[model samples]
Target: MAESEAILAAWDAYSDRHSDADGWPLDEVAYGWRMVQRDSETWRAFLPVRPGARQLLATAAFQLQHLSAGDIAPHWPSHLRDLNQALDRLEELRRGHAEVREARRTSGPVSQEKFIDSVAERNEEAWGYLDTWAAKGHVLLDVHAAAYKAPVRWVPTPAPTTVPARRAGRHV
Candidate 1:
């Protein structure tokens, strides 16, 4: 129960941090170019560059799924076009950012030029749409999270076995 609240709080904080853009300088934020960018809908954090923007697509997947649920906002479908457009932009930006990094790596430190463009632009653009959607349906997250809270799993680790006799297959 507590853990679920923590998760919801963390998710809200993250969404706020990434989407607020009040004092954040989109140009200076390395998240767009240097670090991986996460979309608001997915509720994920920084991820690494990957093949074909799988993480990039996850935003649309989550949004689409949430819309399909039909219990969120009364007008979730209104955001579908924007979400799809954001998906396209995100995919392009991610691919371009990856290519830029590859170019910089191969061209040696001397090559000041990179294949990267205004990554922040695409990132902010995508999040702008997502933020609008989230703001419109802000209640959904809280209500859903509270309603469907799951039990926290506790994984216990085995004690250390530094001694040879303590080995699993050895002297019991």
Candidate 2:
């Protein structure tokens, strides 16, 4: 099997083995957020210096928001507003980055240094939003665990035989 398939299989087995008293499948939700948290941390190591890091972080944030709007919302209504706010900030950051890229492309080599400086400035701003997003995610995870009496700690699964290819220019 492909590595993703193997990972999914393992995740499925793990989820099957762990559920709340009401059969709410709390472990799957908590585990998904945990993975997102791990990836967010990994992304952070290089994100403050690399504007290219925005996409991965944005994707994770959006996914988490989607989860909150769906299955997780009913249980944690209070956190939904915070998650939405974080996602809105992230979207604003993304748009700001896009404008910088567009300006750089049109202005040509004469403004290369300026472009770099702009990216650096935006990177710091991006980090603030990402940090808050991750923090909110952690809070939601904690609330989920506490409400359902689910374990917050992740149980290790066997490694996939073949790792997936990393995206070009991405740290995580």
Candidate 3:
């Protein structure tokens, strides 16, 4: 199986093991995968973390920490442990991803330098996962930004008008 597939499966099983009595068992890996599968447009720059998703990850991570040594399978809990660490840094990655995506939405395709700068302003550990995602074909970056500098055009918005301007430039 592919590494990401294994990661996803381990996360699924890990999350499934921990759902509480008061509520339904949430499969957090599924949630994360669903979010990742969305179109780029759905990702707004600096989009706030989804509360439900965050809670699911936190709960699963908490449970994973208490695993017995026998439960520590190199392909499973160990995988979840790594995923938990990756999930821990997701906020930073999400922010950077959103920033670049939003900039692209508003200005045009995002530049690599701007994306790099945005990533650099945040924690490297966080950016590392994002870069991994990009490398794994889950995301992409502008090659121009990787090469020569370029300008991004602003998206046109309706011009706001003052009362005077609205009234044919006549004073009240």
Candidate 4:
């Protein structure tokens, strides 16, 4: 199976195994796991250039799934919409910053610009929405913890060839 499929399978297995630990029924845990995995996949796919916005989405996803499973009714769609708008703005700002950066890099001694400031503003707005949504329900991440961990994989290395020997017990 592919790596994503394997990861998902593992996650499913883990959730099933741990379903009893939670105070909910088996179906609730399964549903929550699926929701978390779906959002995780979405954020993993779209990781924006915005600094904290991506993390905000990740934390929101986890918290929403957890809350939903725990019988909490949250306005997840409205929250997601707010974050989505902020992400769009951040993306625009990020593109502008990149263009400015490239222009300065190609040219020489360009005047200082508000690239960092633009990024800060966009990122701050996105984070603000995230914070607001978290206040209404739950925040999966702590102040110091990052909301997401980018997916990574290991590749196998080729084995070295051995020299030929005339006999197993005796050398030529």
lDDT by residue for model 2 over 57-149, one digit each (tens)?
Answer: 354444445443334445344444565565567667668878888866786653767775565555546555554544444544444444355
Please write out the lDDT profile of model 4 over residues 1-172, one tens digit for every residue: 1333444456567666656666444687566546455434433333432366667667666645444233432455465656566566646655766777787789775656465444444444443333343342222242113223322235688886986657668855
Clashes of 2: 0
The Cα error of candidate 2 at residue 129, in Å, is: 1.9
Computed on alpha carbons, the lDDT of every model, listed in order, comes to: 0.45, 0.52, 0.45, 0.49
Task: List runs of model 1 lying over 4 Å from the truth.
Answer: 1-73, 110-172
* Model 3 residue 171 CA deviation in Å: 88
Candidates ranked, most accurate by TM-score first:
2, 1, 4, 3
Which model is ahead, 1 or 2, in terms of lDDT? 2
Residue 12, candidate 3: Cα error in Å is 22
Q: Which structure among the candidates has the greatest lDDT?
A: 2
- Clash list (residue pairs), candidate 4: none
Clashing pairs in 3: 45-98, 112-145
TM-score of 3: 0.27
- For model 1, give the RMSD to the true fold: 14.7
